[model samples]
Target: MISETMESHKKDSPSDIKCGIITLSDSLKEKGNEGIEEDLSGQYLFERLSEKYEVSAYVLIADESDKLIQAISNMNSKGIDVIFTTGGTGLESRDITIETLVPRFDKVILGFGEEFRRKSFEKLGSGALLSRSTAGIYNKTIIFALPGSPNAVEMGLNLIYPEIGHLVKHARK
Candidate 1:
């Protein structure tokens, strides 16, 4: 949760931004939607962001690196300010989300993963380190890759979304 002081800081200048929400999971793509848990988390994030900006697009795809790259390229080409992807960010061999994003990023936001793990550790202890959550900018689009779990998505959304507009605006400049 953002502190009251931080929330107040945003009141003075809030950009009406456009965002993209993507869920990376084989099941989601095969089933044609994120499961109930992922769907709920996505909905929560979308509604929260919509309060401040607009969700321009949403996608659900498998954990394949090529597909992930393609999706990101498509979203960036469409002029989305930010792309938030949930799932496939872990140590597992199949968790290539970060790898796929690396070559595409213009500037990697290293602090996001560090801060997310630090904050999550306050709740889940050392287990937070297992998350491969990361954030970066690619072709002027801010990209965030979060763990597959619903709780992880919630944590990332609550902790990171507040600064998304600022990051995107600065990246464009």
Candidate 2:
């Protein structure tokens, strides 16, 4: 039933979606964009995403709300179809990505976080629950907040990449 229900909405759409990569890490932001060397997870996201989608913007910002808002605005200005934020979704006090972005979401994609945890749980045991990764529609763009670690980013990217274009089509409305 669910598969058929989902299949009903599976209409044809172009896949030339543009993307933006944002790294929310206070430590890396201290070095500015020059800190790209230390941003392994973000770099990985950029490289992988760039293969199928155009990476319009890649930025490193502190876990501050102002910085996050600004980055999203810049991405929106470029008409980015989706924004992927890595880091600041863990249990640390500086993990403000999800908290700062959630209130602004026009529609939260709840299944993203839930499924991410479920998938992570298989590999990480109970520690997977500590991740607060989330996804949503904001400013007509799809934003996915993922964890900071390289492994987590890899998993999150793999989980979402195939559906990104499909997800963007709905959010574009």
Candidate 3:
């Protein structure tokens, strides 16, 4: 069944897939308050995703839910196939990425979060439970909320990269 689905997607899966990388942070700034910082996690996402997809947009914003929503809305308008967000997935007061994005999802990819935590536990033991990394579909675009750590971003992407093309293809259909 899965193989048939992949076969069906091969014809419709976009070759020039466009992706967006969003870094959610309040403390990380570039100059004054107008720009963003280096955003290593976001940069990691850009590099890894660039190998397969065209990174159409990348931005940094605060942990505020409104700001996150605004950023996502803007990205969605740009016809982005996927959006990868790093940070604000913890238990801290400002860690609201999961809370902010989940409710807006048209379909939640529960397996992504479950598998992410399973992989995370192998590397970080019980500490993985504190991470709220997740993935879902909204407005025909796939969104992944990852932990702030660069390691988490890499791991999460590595696990999901294989399915992104198929997911995007099905969503658009």
| lDDT per model vs. reference | 0.80, 0.89, 0.87
Error of 1 at 64 (Å): 0.6
Which candidate comes out best when scored by TM-score? Answer: 2
Q: Model 2, 1-173: lDDT tens per residue?
A: 35765555655544889999999888888897678888999999989998888999999988888899999988998999999999888777778898899999999999999999999999999988798999999989999999998999999988997677678878887
**Worst 10-residue lDDT window, candidate 1:** 33-42
Listed per model in order, the count of residue pairs whose N, CA or C atoms clash below 3 Å is 0, 0, 1
- Runs of candidate 1 with Cα error greater than 4 angstroms are 1-14, 33-38
Task: Compute the lDDT for candidate 3.
Answer: 0.87
lDDT of residue 129 for candidate 3: 87
Query: Which one wins by TM-score: 1 or 3?
Result: 3
The TM-score of candidate 1 is 0.86
2 or 3, greater by TM-score = 2
Query: Which scores better on lDDT, 2 or 3?
Result: 2
Q: Which pairs of residues clash in candidate 1, taking residues 3 or more apart in a chain or in different chains? A: none
Q: How many backbone clashes does candidate 2 have?
A: 0
lDDT of 1: 0.80
* lDDT: worst 10-residue window of model 3: 29-38
